[model samples]
Target: MPRGSALSQSLIDTAHALADAARAETLAHFRNPGLDAANKAAAGFDPVTEGDRAAEAAMRAILAERRPGDGVFGEEYGITRGSSGLTWVLDPIDGTRGFLSGTPTWGVLIAACEGTRPVYGIIDQPFIGERFEGGLGVARYRGPQGEAPLRSRQGVALKDAILFSTFPEIGTAQEAARFREVSARARLTRFGMDCYAYGLLALGHVDLVIEAGLQRYDIAGPIAVIEAAGGIVTDWQGGPADEGGRILAAGSPELHAEALALLSGTAAEGAA
Candidate 1:
């Protein structure tokens, strides 16, 4: 349907319910998170924990019972067969390292992409007690029953900006150098943040999110929420969202292009 006017209300409700359940499960583990992280899939990569596995499993089960025809692509568990028209992308824990580091940037992430294009998105930070969702030209945030409109900060300069970046895990040396060079000139830099920083930006807390290396799961949910809040979400070269090489999220389009001009120069040098 590509997020038409006549979308499924049932699907939206299912997304909310799934997000709520994920929040509950993730919150329980957030308080008493025990470390049993194993490298199951990749070398030096932490596999799914009891919390992640349980949460994803629960979501999978619920979806199976309700929308049994929708396919799923989860970071922890991998792909499933169902909706070719609708795909559910899940990152059981977006910032597991942050989750383990006693930082609050860790959270649960999910998005319903209507055929590789995100139509509905949800970012649930259970520990901090915030939930952000965007779809169908409607983007807003909520804590409980009260929903409020979210607006991005306007008239912000790059040198006077706050950047939320996590480059150490995903970037190569060249990419890291470029990230550092650009971030060093920013007003302040916060690192190792995943979707949480984007959520904050959507809520008008931060200014920019610069990502050089990412998969579809990393910025999938944020793209919709941040844009819904009247911000810019794009690749490093300032293109579409899902192409996935580098990403720059900014509060305004002007700042986005400025920062992108600087970062893209770096990317060009690296290519040279």
Candidate 2:
């Protein structure tokens, strides 16, 4: 719905509540020596820790009490259909692997999505005590340095851009080759920041983040936050990215276009 509306405000409030609940639950198991994960993937090591489940359950409990009519699509619990025409997309810990490794980059991602589009979102890092919220006329960061408005960097050329991806060997072989093509021209390319990378992008500390083989919950919160901070987020084909798949987020439209062209293998000669 529209920003500042009663429903909008309520949704924003509920998102924060969810984040708060997740922070408490996730931190309880964050660095515990007994922390163990179950392989969720059939072929590979897709781990899910106790912290992930506990956090999602806590968030779901709050939603059941506050926004009972809203649907939920969570990484741990799957989907819970509701009648409110909205869905709470939750990834209790966006980087379970890193969380298992005791890195502070793991985060709780919560987005109040209307249909497939996120209307408000929060990326909360419990260990760092940092929260980045966007959408619904709110784009700000709260961290040790204090609160600040979030504005993505503008006018950075492709060659000067700082690029980030969660994994160096992104997606399939074709996708990895495409990613390398863009990385070759960027000023710097780093990996494995997870959702924290998106937070940095919205804060204007980073310029671009590209990833593939993502689910809706993986990118929904980041999409709302980054776009609210004057950034552009789309698929490699330049389509709406909230549905996931391949995502390309850049601090500015010009930079996004350059990166998109390269990712799609459509840039003209010398465009990079």
Candidate 3:
């Protein structure tokens, strides 16, 4: 339960291993001419490629062998419940659209949860060799360049912050309006980075990330990474984000409070 305990280290190592195994599987199918991409959404064009299935399957295999009693929840495959309180969450290719479009921003997400709380997480971008890992009291970035400690920016003002969202049309009418409210006040706003945006936030390159219509797998890994890096992550209403719809992450507590006030419409526009 305490930070940096033996159990935490073991879970972190397991997360890295799972991400490594998934990276291999996703790389094989990524951007291949023969890669089969199909729509998984009922009425819209939500894509699922062979890479997604293969990568998740690969990670599931490792979990089955190494943490046999742990539960597994993956995007491609359905849930495999385990008696152990730990549940491994997998999103083989987080930015599937980016991957299909040959963008290197896609990442493999792996997280270990004890009950409803995430204890460890890793965001692995194999193509670029960047791995952002965090849990309990530790967060770090590892890549071909080198490894370094991670910390969020301090004293960031809301009006001067950089913001990101996966897409503008992602959520309902109200959610879109809420996002617009925050984006309008930020110094700059960018779109289409997917989960990669969260990693950038944790690294202090970006200051805020607000998005809606997300599942648990989408934010669990990033939430752990961001929080461990000293950022705040919560639902738009400033509640727990573990269930994942309408989430907000900020580099500092002051910034987070400012964003939440705007998001909740408690602070009028142009209010200091």
RMSD of each: 2.9, 1.5, 1.9
Best by lDDT: 2
- Please give the lDDT score for candidate 1: 0.78
What lDDT does candidate 2 reach at residue 170? Answer: 98
Worst 10 residues of 2 by lDDT: 1-10
> lDDT of model 1 at residue 9?
64
**lDDT values for all models:** 0.78, 0.93, 0.87
Which clashing pairs does model 3 show?
none
Shift of residue 28 alpha carbon in model 1, Å: 3.0
- Each candidate structure's count of clashing pairs: 3, 0, 0
lDDT for each residue of candidate 3 in 1-272, tens digit (9 for 90 to 100)? 34457877777777878888888998998778777679998997789998999899889988888889999988889789999788888899999999999899999988888777787788889898899988766799988889988788889898999999999795888778878888889999999999899999988899999998899999889988998899999988899998788899999999999999888777865574
Question: How would you order the candidates by TM-score, starting with the best?
Answer: 2, 3, 1
TM-score of each predicted structure versus truth: 0.89, 0.97, 0.95
Best-fitting candidate, measured by TM-score?
A: 2
Per-residue error at 197 for model 2, in Å? 0.3
lDDT of 2: 0.93
